[model samples]
Target chain A: MKAKIYVTLKPGVLDPQGKAVAHSLHDLGFDDVADVRQGKYLEVELTTPDKKKARADLEEMCKKLLANTVIEDYRIEIE
Target chain B: MKSAVIVYPGSNCDRDMQVALRKITGSEPLMVWHGDSDFDKVDLIAIPGGFAYGDYLRSGAIAARSPVMREVVRRANQGVFVLGVCNGFQIVAEAGLLPGALMRNRDLKFLCKDVHLRVENAKTAFTSHYAGGQVIRVPVAHFDGNYFASDDELKALEDNGQVVFRYCTGDGELTGEANVNGSMHSIAGIINKPGNVLGMMPHPERLIEDILGGRDGRALFKSLLKTFPLAA
Candidate 1:
C-alpha cells in the first residue's frame, strides 16, 4: 500500500517562501495570482495491506515527524 | 558543573559549545554522539547550532528524532537543564520540548550578524545573570530563525513568562526595525514550562570572551554555573 501526504503551513502562519514566490510571480506578470502558500508532498510505501492500518500508520508518521503540528497541518490519503 | 554537548553528524558548533562549557565550568564537557543513547549524566546538555543531518526535511526535524535526542528528551523530562541554540532551538521545538516553531526569515534570506536582545525574563536558569530589560549583543545565523506559534500558544507563552529574551534596539526598546527575524513578540529566547529547558536563536557560545568582539553572551553561560561569573 502507498500513502500520499500533503503537509502545509497553517493558514494564519507567515509563509515567507510562499510570499517571495508570489512576488516573483507578480514580477513575471502573473498579477492575477492573489496569494501562494508552500507545503510538502510526501508518498510513503506501507507494508500494511489494510487501508485502515495504512491510514493509522501514516497519521502516526505525520504526528511524529512528517509534519510539525504546531504550524503545519497534514492530509493523508491511503491506497 | 558537569555538562555535555550532543554532537549530531552535521553539528559544527559542538566544539565551540564544548569550549564554552569547559571555559565557564572549569570542567570538560562530555562529547556525546548522536547515535549513542547512553552517557554519563550531566548537570547541563547543550544542542549546538549546525546543519544537523544537512538540515533535511526541516532544519532540525531529522536530528530531533535521532537516537540521542530521544534520550535528551527523556533527560529533559527528568529536570535536567537543556540549552538549545539556533538549530538546537529548532530541534528542541521539533522534539516537542518547546512550543512553537522556527520558520524562514521574513526576507527569505539567511541572516548572519549581531543583533541586540533585551532580557525579558531574568529568573530562568539560563538568564539569571542578565538583569531584566538589559540589552546585549549576540549573533544570529540561520535561515529559519523566525519563530511562529499558534494564537493560544502565544498567549500562554506570554502569560506564563516563558519569553526570556526579545529582539530590541541597543537602548532596549522593542520596535519593528529591531526584530531581526519576524519572531512573534520579537522573542529571541524562551524557557519551557518547567523552566529547565531553554531554546534561543542567538549563539551565546560564540561570544564568551572579549577577544570575540564582545562578552555579552558570557552571562547566559555564567547564569548556569553561578560559581564563576565572567570577570567584570
Candidate 2:
C-alpha cells in the first residue's frame, strides 16, 4: 500500500517561502492570487494491507517524525 | 573538561565546536557520530550549527530522530549540560528538549551576519559568565532561525525566567528593527526549565577569538567551567 501525507504549517505560523512565491506571482501579473502557503507532500510505501491499520500507523508516523506538531499539521491518505 | 560534539552526516560546525571546546578546556572534545547511541559520560555535549542530513524533511527534523539525538535527549534529561547552536537549536527543539520550533526567516532570506544579543538570564550553565543585561555581538547564519512557540508556552518561559538572550541593538535596546529573524519575544536563546540545556540561534563558537573580529563568545564557553569547576 501507498500513503500520501500532506504536511502544512499551522495557522498563524509564518510561511516565508510561501510569501516569496506570492510576491513573485504578483510580479508576474497574477494579481488575483491573494495568498500562497507552501507545504510538503510525502508519499510513503507501506507493507501493511489493512487500510485502517495503515492510516493509524501513518498517523503515528506523522506525530513522531513526518510532521512537527509544534508548527505543522499533517493529513494521511492511504491508497 | 570531557566534552563531546555530536556530528551528523552534514554537520559543518562540529569541527568549529571541537576547536572551541579544545581552546577553552585545553582538551579535544569527542566527536560522536549520529549513529552512536552512547555519550561516554562526558561533562558537556554540543550540537553545533550546520545542515545536518542535508536538512531534509525540515531543517532539523530528520536529524532530531537520529540515534545520537535519542541519547542526547536522555542525557539532557539527566542534567548533563547541552549547548545547541543554530541548526543545533532547531534539532534540540525538534527533539523536544526545548520548547518552540525554529521556522524560516520572516523575509524568506538566508541571514548571515553579526547581531547583538542581550543576556537575559545569567544563571544557566551556559551564560553564567555573562552579566545580566550585557549586550554581546555574535553572528547568526541560518535560513530557519525564527523561533515560534505557543502563547502559553511563551508566557511560561517568561514566568520561569527561561529566556537567556534577546536580540537587541548594540546599545542594548530591544526594538522591532533589531530583531533579525522575527523570533517570538525577540528570543535569541533559551534554556530548559531546569536550565541544564540551552539552545540559541547565534553561533557563539564562531566568535571565540579576537582574530574572528570579536571575543564576545568566549564567556559562554567559560561559563561551563564556572558552573562545574571540576570540569575545568
Candidate 3:
C-alpha cells in the first residue's frame, strides 16, 4: 500500500515560512493572494495493503514521531 | 558533581556543555550517546544546542524521539535535573517534557547575535544564581526559536511562576525586537511543572568563561553545583 500524509501548522499558529512566501509572491506582483500557509506532504510506501492497519500505523507514526500535535495537524490517505 | 551530556548525531554544543560542566564541577561530564538506555547515575543531564538530526522535518522533531530521550524522560519524571538549550529546548518541548512548540522566527531570519534577557523568576533550580529582574547578555543563534503556547497555558505559567527568562533591551526594558523570536509572553526560558527540568533557547554554556564574552552564565553552573544534592 502507498500512503500520503499532509502535515500543516494548525490555525492561530504562526507560520513564518508561509508568511515569507506570501511576501515574496506579493513582491512578484501577485496582489490577489490573501494568505499562504506552507505544509509538508509526505509519501510513504508500505508492504501491507490493508487500509485499516495502514491508517492505524500512520496515526501512531504521526503521534509519536511525524507530526507535532501541539502545533501541527496531520491527515493520511492510503491507496 | 556527576553530569551527563546527551550527544545526538548533529549536536555541535555537546563538548562546550561538557567543558562548562567540568569547569564548574571540577569533574568531566559523561558523554552519553543518543542510543544509550541508561543515564549512568548522573546528577545533571544537559541537552545542548545545535541542529540535531539536521533539523529535518521540524526543528528538534526527529531528535525528540531518539532512544536517549526516552531514558531522559524517564529520569526527568523521577525529579532529575535536566537542562535543554536552544535546539535542545525545542527537543524537550517536542518530547512533551514542556508545553508549547518553537516556530520559525517571526522575521523569518536566522538570528545570530548577543541579546539581553531578564531573569524573570530566579527561584527555580536553573536561575537561583540571579536575582529576579536581573538582565544578562546571552547569545541566541537559531532560525526557529519562537515559542508558542495557548492562552490558558500562558496564564498557568504566569500563575505558577514557571517563566524563568524574558528578552529585554540593554537597559533592562522589554522591547519588541528584544523578544528576539517573538516568544509568547516574551518567554525565553521556562521550567517544567515540577521545576526540576528547564528548557531555554539561550546558550549559557557559551558564556560560562570570560574569554567567550561575559561571565554572567557562570553563576548558573555555580548555583547548580551548590544546590544539587549528592546521590544517596
Candidate 4:
C-alpha cells in the first residue's frame, strides 16, 4: 500500500515562501490568484495491506516526525 | 562546570561551543557523537549550530530524532541544564525540549549578522550573569530562526517569565526592525517551564572572545558556571 501525505503550515502561521511565490504570480499577470499556501507532498510505501494500519501508522509518523504539529497540519490518503 | 557538546553530522559550530565551554567552565567538553547515547551525564549539555542531515525534511527535524537527542530529552527532563543555539535551538524545539517552533525568516533568507538582544529574564540560570534589560550583541546565522507558538502557549511562556531574551535596539528598545527574523514578541531566546533548558537563536559562542568581534556572549557562559559551580 502507498500513502500520500500533505503537510502545510497551519492557518495564521506566516508562509513567507508562499507569499513570495504569490508575488511572482501577480507579476506574471495571474490576477485571479489571490493567495498561495505552500506545503509538502510525500509518498510513502508500506508493507501493511491493512488500510487501517497504514492510516494509523501514517498518523503517528506525521505527529512524531513528518510534521511539527506546532505549526503544520498534515493529511494522509492511502492508495 | 563539566559540560559536553553534542556533535551532530554537519554541525559546524560544535568546536566554537566546545571552546567557549572549555574557556568558561575551565574543562574540556566531551564531543559526543550523535549516535552515542551512553556518554556519562555532565553538568551541562550544549547543542551547536549547522545544517544537520542537510536539513533534508525540515531544519533539525531528522537530527532531533537521532539517538543522542533521545538522551538529551531524557537528561533534560531530570533537570539537567541544556543550552541550544541556532540550529541547536531548532533541534531542541523539534524534540519537544522547548515550546514554540522556529520557522523560516520572514524575508526567506539566511540571516547572518550581529543583533542586539535585551535580557528579558535575567533570573534564568542561563542569563544570571547579565542584568535585566541589558542589550547584548550576539550573532545569529540561520534560515529558520523566526519563532512561533500558539497564542495560549505564548501567553503562558510570558506569564511564567520564560522569555529570557528579545531582539531589541542597541539602546535596549524593542522595535520591529530589530527583530530581524520576525520572531513572536521579538523573542531571541526562551527557557522551558522547568527553567532547566534554554534555546536561543543567537550564537553566544561566536561572540565569546574579544578578537572575534565582542565578548557579549562570554557572560552567558559565566552565568551557567555560576548556576552549577564545581565542588570546592
Which candidate number has the best DockQ? 4
**Regions of model 1 farther than 4 Å from truth:** B227-232
User: lDDT (0-100) at residue A11 of candidate 3?
Assistant: 95
Every candidate's lDDT: 0.91, 0.92, 0.89, 0.93
The fraction of reference interface contacts (C-alpha pairs within 8 A across chains A and B) present in each candidate is: 0.88, 0.94, 0.82, 0.94
Better by DockQ, candidate 2 or 1: 1
lDDT tens digits by residue: candidate 1, B1-232: 8889999988989998999998877789999999998999888899999999999989999999999999999999999999999999999999999999999988888999999999999988788889988999999999998999888998999999999989999999999889989998898999999899999999999999999889998889889987333331
Q: Report the Cα lDDT for residue B134, model 4.
A: 90
- Worst ten-residue run, lDDT, model 4 chain B? B223-232
Candidate 1 CAPRI grade: high
RMSD of every candidate to native, in Å, equals 2.4, 1.3, 1.3, 0.8
Best by lDDT: 4
Regions more than 4 Å wrong, model 3: B229-232
Q: Docking quality tier of candidate 3?
A: high
Per the 3 Å backbone cut-off, how many clashing residue pairs does candidate 4 have? Answer: 0
> What's the TM-score of each model vs. the native?
0.96, 0.97, 0.97, 0.99
Query: What's the lDDT for residue B164 in model 4?
Result: 94
Better of 1 and 4 by DockQ: 4
Pitting candidate 1 against candidate 4, the one with the higher lDDT is: 4
Residue-level lDDT tens digits of model 4 in B23-142: 888888999999999998798999999988888789999999999999999999998899999999999999999998999998899999999999999998899899999989999999
Give the per-residue lDDT of model 2 (tens digit) for B1-232: 6889999988998998998988986777899989988758888899999999999998999999998999999999898889999999999999999999999887778999999999999887888889999999999999998999999999999999999999999999999889999899999999999888999999999999989899999999899877766545
